[model samples]
Target chain A: MQINLPSLDGTENITAVCMRPDRYTRLYEALTCDTPVIARGGGLSYCNAGAGRGCRTVVSTCFDRILAFDAEKRLLTVEPGMRLGDLFEFAVRHGLYFPVLPGHPSITVGGCAGFNVHGKTQHNVGHFIDYVERFTLFHPDHGEITCSRTDHESLFRLTIGGFGLTGYITNITLRLIPLKGRSVLFQKRFVANLKEAVEVMKQLSEKVDVLYSWNNLNKTGDAFGEGIVFSEQFIDEETSARDKPFHLFTPDMRSVLRFNFYYRPSAHMECAVYYNMERLTGVEKRCALKATAFPIHGKEIYYLLFGKQGLREYQMLIPHDEWAGALDDLRALMNRMKMPLTLGSMKFFTGAQDLLNYRGDGICLVLDVPANRNSVEYFNKLDEIVIAHKGVVNLSKDSRLTAGTVATMFPEYERFKNELNEFDPKKRFNSALRMRIDV
Target chain B: MSDKKTAVVIGASSGVGRAMARELAYRGYRLVLVARDRAELDILAGDLRIRAKVEAVVSPLDLAAATTSGIQEFVARCAADHPAIERVAITAGQVSDDDQGPTPLPLLESIVKTNYLAVIELVAGFARHMEQHAGGTIAVCSSIAAATPRGRNTVYSSAKAGLETYCRGLQHHYRDTPVRIQAFALGYVDTAMSFGQKLLFPAASAEDTARYMADKMSTDFRVGFYPRFWRPIVMVLAHLPWGVYKRMKF
Candidate 1:
């Protein structure tokens, strides 16, 4: 079977079954038939985060359903294949909120749990794991086990950021937060460069619910790292009974975008115009919750824009102590190499995780460098800088991770590997990233 | 042309399978269209129901993540809906086995994975379902390139050849049985795979291939040549001496 989801290219006859999200018969089939089974949910990952190298029997949870929703508990239990966007809509319908909304709408709950994905407001709150109450893991050998913060705490913690290698995370119980009338106040400010932006972001993080900066990686000289730092906080304080706004684009606009990206991304020009437009105003605006949360709603265009060669997102968490010097060196390298940083985002993380963890109490810089050129060479160079600063790369979004880089970047790599071996000795759960990282 | 007589097109989202789906629906058979994209499948199913006026069951399958029994369960569900599965056509194969440049091992293995393992499992699953019903056709879309192995497409050529052999072996297994297997040895097909490549001969459209395969599905003959004329051409090439075949570039 030929399956192409976003940037990840998977060529498999996909030997496994497409059952309703209810049953765990896939594990039995994998065991009985003597084959390896990989759980696939939503298939929204940019890299082969949900996929393995070569081909393996795929147990897809595409038959997604909302199993149970306890309004009193403010908890929702959904099939892992449920998309984050769908979950957001579901939450808002019930006058609630589910905050670990990844920028991409197509991302699933299973993928969020697997990667322990974070939002723009990570510094203010925490990663996706914080909202998760419990989840059911269909272990290849152990069968289905319900794990959470209390019962089997180690498994629960490990599985949160475990990259789907632990087992098939069939169902997830997410503790829903309260929605403040589906309205948000957005503040956008212009920062000349990273050095000044750092202090500004630190100050903004304390004031706003969400704070992040989009740096202009293309600019050099005095304008290097020049970007607009945006902040968002719910503005339901004044207004009452705010209805959620979901903007659906017309078909013609989508078609044009789909076609334009094939030739070259018209989006870069649009971003430039947006930056200039925001600079002109330099004021706060009242916006919809959807507008604030999913800024890049039409990310399918971004993936198509990358073309066949694909894109690599080198997201590194630079600690507070080392960000100043390391980022300066990285900026110099980017200027000298003339590296094509298509998109660069910097945000603050105020949490940490143990195994294959990307979280840390520091600033994380995500550089979306196009893989069209010999950019892997540039990424490798950046990895060295990350290693010096003891900054770990984001496991969920990375493309070309090596054993050496994983070992250097993640100090807990050895312990994670040891623990993983103990639980999944047969190594039933595997992916391309797992192979690359040798874990 | 009973609605009970269903046809399962494995790659119904696009290419040959999609065209085959339309052809089958026109032929008055309910369809089980399988693919990874559920949204595409849903839209296609809705369109098929309205335009084709046939029951099109959307089977959203990510084959890479599926197991053998998982496929059985998939077939079972389809059987539960449109009981009599009279035809199972698998036209879902990728030609990413081009080794002109340095290719990774995992990527190289995917050639066998997609072209062989995936299709064979589908055949085994659906073939069993059809056999119990005691009347059905198994049509597999293969390539003319498989007639003779080449270094340029080593994994694809070998896997395709292996697929043909598997079908032949199945033929021997079901010789006494009424189950029919049609191995379509196709010549140049003007698909995305054939695009930008210099064609030595006029390539067949996906529609032509699908129509021919769907019409001649129940034929007594096991192997079919799409466009019909390529039978003699591929026959000549299959018997060529290895020494001479090695020097010739496809």
Candidate 2:
């Protein structure tokens, strides 16, 4: 069967077969087939963690359920098919929460677990595996194996953020945040340029709970990093103390259309950001925590804004020492390629703990470039810049990277393959992204 | 942990019960979270501990099992562990098993046991515990389904109706005592139960519904509507003539 999955960046996901697995037994059975296999979650990953395309792809959405929940212990044992929205709803309702979750609610537990995703508060809270107590895996030959800190420790680290290369993760036991309040205290400060932004981040790194910034992409000449710095703190209060508790999200087509039609970071978009940044400078706002969880607008709208062709998201982590120099190389590459970036976001990472982790004592910069003729080569060059800087490309977000390039970047890539090969030596497990990167 | 004021939140795992528990926790109340899923309950407790910086204990019980005395045992456990209990919020609800044709009697019985009988047992046990403390508050969640019983969700509606009736008696019983009981009549709420479906008019978010219920429960009102908009809607529907109401679709 012909299955097409278009990423948020407009690249079509063309695959020969797609298998929806309801149980771990079924997933194991599917893995035994002759063709290469990969698992697809909620499909929120712009990066190719699913590894679809000409492979026997098993969609994991049907595997959804809350197998066990220990709210006090803050442990969630769930199937990979569960969506972040459901988990967030369940967690917040219980006065608990999940950390380092990507903004889009459609992102699945399996996807986050596989990629070990992080969000705005990552610098403070850490990655997906930070909360993961353990995971239940289905090996092609070994059957079900439980991996955690106490048991199968290396396998546990390998499996987490391993991009499903190790085996199929059927269930995950995660530690969660037991938050008292349903909201966060947010503040936005404007910076003059990248220099000021880095300085401010250094000062606030240990002080604030939430920290990240949006770049002034619309600016020309020297003001590339000049934009808004958004910082937030989780308020400690009873959820009941608020005057208004329920702030529902309703999708409006008008905003979607506007973004789709005229939402590029062009002069008009730049002007909007400029005024918004000017007005929001030094202003602190408090809102229900969910308000901050997703973007102030919504992911759906931002998604729709990409239009039919879609946009490519290239995220890379550059060391703190080379951060400014790397940005110079990046801007030059974008200029040389003539592919102007639509959006850019920067966040601080303390370091990575997972086997194939992106976190490091560095600055992670994510760029949104409209998918076009120049885009692929531009991304490839971006990978080169990261490798040169002794930084790592966010494999979970990069579709253009190759195994050769990733090997040079992530020193642990060879070991990750060795660990994976030990379980499925024939290399039956794969995804389009993993294969593209030659992983 | 024990030094803080304690609140025993029933249905602390999801829906309005989950919301109400979260709201109360923000008010600086130590919590004993009760639900069938101990894992989820503990997750909530963990959240309260981290976010509110308060102690939240988990007490998971099968609300439907009768002979095993799920409610009695759970309350006994609460009294033993959290003796300073001041509030009890029941936000648990149930629906018909929609899997096969013609819902079975056992499933209907389970629905009633969870939605009605288990609730009464919890109130009776907690009411006694609250009798020792002054200004103890007990809040229960009813539904719009109770006002007009329809054929589709007959068991669920009847269970809610029975619960509301019991609350009336509970109010009378606790009239002289400081233990006050509040009933929340809520309309359509956007929750996991209502996931991937379109709901009727006058719907609100779970966070909003939870916050509203938590705040009002602290007041003197015996009964309240979740969004407050639902009160008029339910009132107009209750007064509608059967002939006209029967012709209309829910």
Candidate 3:
């Protein structure tokens, strides 16, 4: 049936034919159909990557299930629809941990694999693809094919960050690392500005188990990037700390109402208040492991506050050496633009860059601005600065990036398109992102 | 080694059946997931075992082709294998949109067997076994379409209506016994069955519907409508005059 499919940031909504299949037989039927299809997990992508204008969007939420968990091997076999929060909770019980997890627990593992998501601890373990051992993808023409580093090596690389265009990912086997304990010493360090925040993050990246910084972009001059740099290190031993159960939060109408409460006062005020409150609060506190990994669960209302007009989320990875120059450009653009930056954050990432994968040695900067008439111009300017610095824009997070911008940012864009075309000439699996990028 | 009671959830692969299995598993009941799709059943069973720390047994069976005696034997085997089997829920149902139009005889028989005959057979088997064993609860899903047979869903609604009447009779017969029977006349549930259909009221999610059914399974409730709002609406519709109803389009 045709349903209104919205992006995570509410930037775009497309009325597409959506099918939610809970069983394997139904999923097979959905994949084998003649119509162009795309697999949707959690529908939490900031862009309209999960749905296309005319293609059928196959929602995999109901297909969520863990097929196998071998604690001895520290390997987990799960369906594409399983949420990261549910995976984390299950892993913690067995004294294992999934290192590369996105902030929102509701984000699906399939999404992470598709986007090649980088997390707070990405500097240490790399992208989500680093942990995915293998996956079984079902294409309409190709049927089911197992892709991994050893077998179908090229297909594996292309499909990892192919944005679900390769096929419908049915089964994924993830390799997990061992955890010391379920508790962490969560610390909040105050930074004076973007320069200071970068210095602190670089210094602590080698020491902290998990590291990320939240900047108050609403501020100007010296206070522009001034915010809290949050760090977490696992406790040596298991304490009697009572951790909250793992919950995959699904937003309801109440969340919208709650978001409007904080939203009407303006996001700038909220940012300043949050920054000042964190500065006043104690630096160190014991926190549950899941809390450190998924801080966005309870605060899902924040995403809703953007309202129907939505917000443009531009996440770019800038090299460590070029970050200083990029920061200057960002400040200059911020001063010149009328659009307020609703959110700004940064995380360290280290990985070998490949076909369309959002991975490299850099400080990933994420910015959210309320969508408006000037959104296109503001982001276009931001895009020029990023491309000049040889930075890569995260296609998964930003919806407004032009096809020209993406081609300019990622050198392997053409190769990805070629490989995808060679694999499936018809491109049976498709989405809005694919159509937008003209890939 | 574990002393947990087992719950059999028929048609546990999809829709409300799938949700019902998850709910029962969460409630600390060892599950017997019965469905025709073995792959789907295995996936669900594995998930329940991991998430809920409960044992789940996958029992693959084609309810449309299942015989009454065959179903009785299966129930007896389940009771014998797990003496702790204290609850049974039948959430299996089938419907074809072609039912409103001219449907083939084979399709009609399949629907009857799946929606009515198979459900009644399983209910009878479970109720009798539970009566002899420890007094267990048996709940089956009916439909709000059964309130009054309309031209929209002729055979499907008729089958559900028959199943509902049979369950009511079973409840009356088991009133003095240890067996407790609950029949849920569900409304438009957000399952594959109602995925694309435009309807007046928003379809209730299968998860929420299953949770309600699971909550009432152990209680003394005999018969009720899911999403309770459907109860009054169906009641009014059932009481409507034949002339007025015939002219209405829903």
Candidate 4:
């Protein structure tokens, strides 16, 4: 069952010792085998968070299924391996929805819970942990235990955003959001700079169902962050009847990016071309919910554009008061370092900080740069800027962050480590991220 | 009332059997899931029920320990409960790593009973049961080891070879009847059966193998090797001179 699986970012290729267990007994057998273990769902983390050297990766994809559903309470209990897209399709059939979803449909619910994933509606809905009512955890030392808000309260908070270090999450019960309809009225607006884009997102979040901004980081000086701000609102059933037919987005493997297509010269040209195409398109359109939520489904080649060397994504949340200054600093660093930015985007997030969870009322900026010598130094310097501005980097997205950097970013770093040690003194569960950060 | 066909999948707890159960459920067949592990079968049944929205009944029967009369009774019960039984696939096989040279008598017997004898019994019971109705498809999975017997799996290869011959004989006998028989000589499948062994080629995933089987269910192919590429390889191995084959180590 062992195979070589790569992280989504393509930087790390792990010779993963994996076992796909379909039943509870087999899951127990895999967990109690006395090897350093981690739970793997879909194997889609940008960093190799589910696999590690000399560790066994328990693949939970076969356990994907809906276990129970309460129609009145709008709550559904599902196995940890069920993909969010499948969950969305199932929920829509019942006239319900789960709003907190990452952009990719292949991500699993366990993955969302493990990383405390946020989506376009983070400012309004918060992280995936807010929707989870309870979960079943299996630990080699503690056996199977049910953790909820009122019972096993500390473990519940620790397990979410714990990045699969506490134990193996077997099943989760999540509260569902009542869906108005599957069709959405989408519109795009041009933004001049990062400041205006952030202002537009904060303004639109009050009325729109979804809000996010895409920036053209390829620009420089005053025109930096020039791009589009997309907003969408759910269409009522009567209005949706006149909309175009909706088909769920399914991921495909055929990629147009057959070689390394990212470099400094073409980076700016490509961004300008992309921006023009979006600018020329319809300002307002009717779209399917799945297509908007998972725009990366058919365009998976973007991940492979950097070729074998892969790419580095620096995603961090800066507080509202400090974001403007932080953006200026980052722009200056990019100008000096000559780092080619491939993609840049931002979303507004509103939530109180939890242990290691990437939550705060701020602007979340994500920049993807090709992995090379200068970019490595560039990210190291960017880390200092973020730390100085009191921003926290997303642990699940970046693979190269140091423990010292994390400790400074998250004030509850030592508390998370100590709590995990007390719960699992033997440290039966582990991952590559855990080892890199030395948690 | 919903009128959907029914499928009986033995050894439906793991690997190809489990994937085949899911495929059949997706194709709108209510399932009778058979396996030794009650817990595994229950989970599979529940999953098929909720995801596929099909009736899935779990029948925990150990093929190795099952009796001829008992298998017949189980099939009869399925027929009585769900009369529209249209397909049955037997995907249960056993092998012990210690079945090398000079294996223990108990292990050898267990392998023979589980791999060859039990399958023959189930095939006969289903053939008789389906003959009474509008006829049905019965598919059994054998291994390519049956064609190229190796030193590492002495007893398992012989048992699978016996099952292969028995299935061919049944196919010829039932050629005159509406009852259809398919015996798949599977190559290395990515299942627990071939989990850790160093394979000659990459193993075909259980899901892909099940998808291939489901696609071929409506066809007339009676005896074929799974992954189709294995057919020529097995033929070449079977035709090689005894001296040449004996010196070869697999």
Q: How does residue A78 of candidate 1 score in lDDT?
A: 78
**Positional deviation of residue A294's Cα in model 2 after best superposition, in angstroms:** 11
Deviation of model 3 at B190, angstroms? 3.7
lDDT of 1 by residue, B98-158 (tens): 5544456776666676778878888877777777876688888788778866667767777
The local lDDT score (0 to 100) that residue A344 gets in candidate 2 is 70
Model 1 ranges with Cα > 4 A deviation: A2-33, A54-61, A237-271, A280-282, B1-250
Against the true two-chain complex, what DockQ does each candidate achieve?
Answer: 0.02, 0.04, 0.59, 0.35
In order of lDDT, best first, we have 3, 4, 2, 1
Per-residue lDDT, model 1, residue A343, is 77
Better of 1 and 4 by lDDT: 4
Which residue runs of candidate 4 sit more than 4 Å off their true CA positions? A1-6, A13-17, A236-259, A269-273, A276-281, B1-4, B95-108, B142-168, B184-190, B193-205, B224-250
Question: Best DockQ goes to which candidate?
Answer: 3
Model 2, docking class: incorrect
- Overlapping backbone residue pairs in candidate 3 total 0
iRMS of candidate 2, Å: 9.4
Give me the displacement of residue A322 in model 2, in angstroms.
9.5
lDDT tens digits by residue: candidate 4, A79-100: 8988888898778878899989
CAPRI quality band, candidate 3: medium
Q: List per-prediction Cα lDDT, in the order shown.
A: 0.72, 0.73, 0.84, 0.84
Locate the minimum summed-lDDT window of 10 residues in model 3 chain B. Answer: B95-104
lDDT for each residue of candidate 2 in A206-229, tens digit (9 for 90 to 100): 988888888765454677567777
Candidate 1: tens digits of C-alpha lDDT, residues A324-350: 889788878876776556777789987
TM-score against truth, every candidate: 0.60, 0.62, 0.90, 0.88
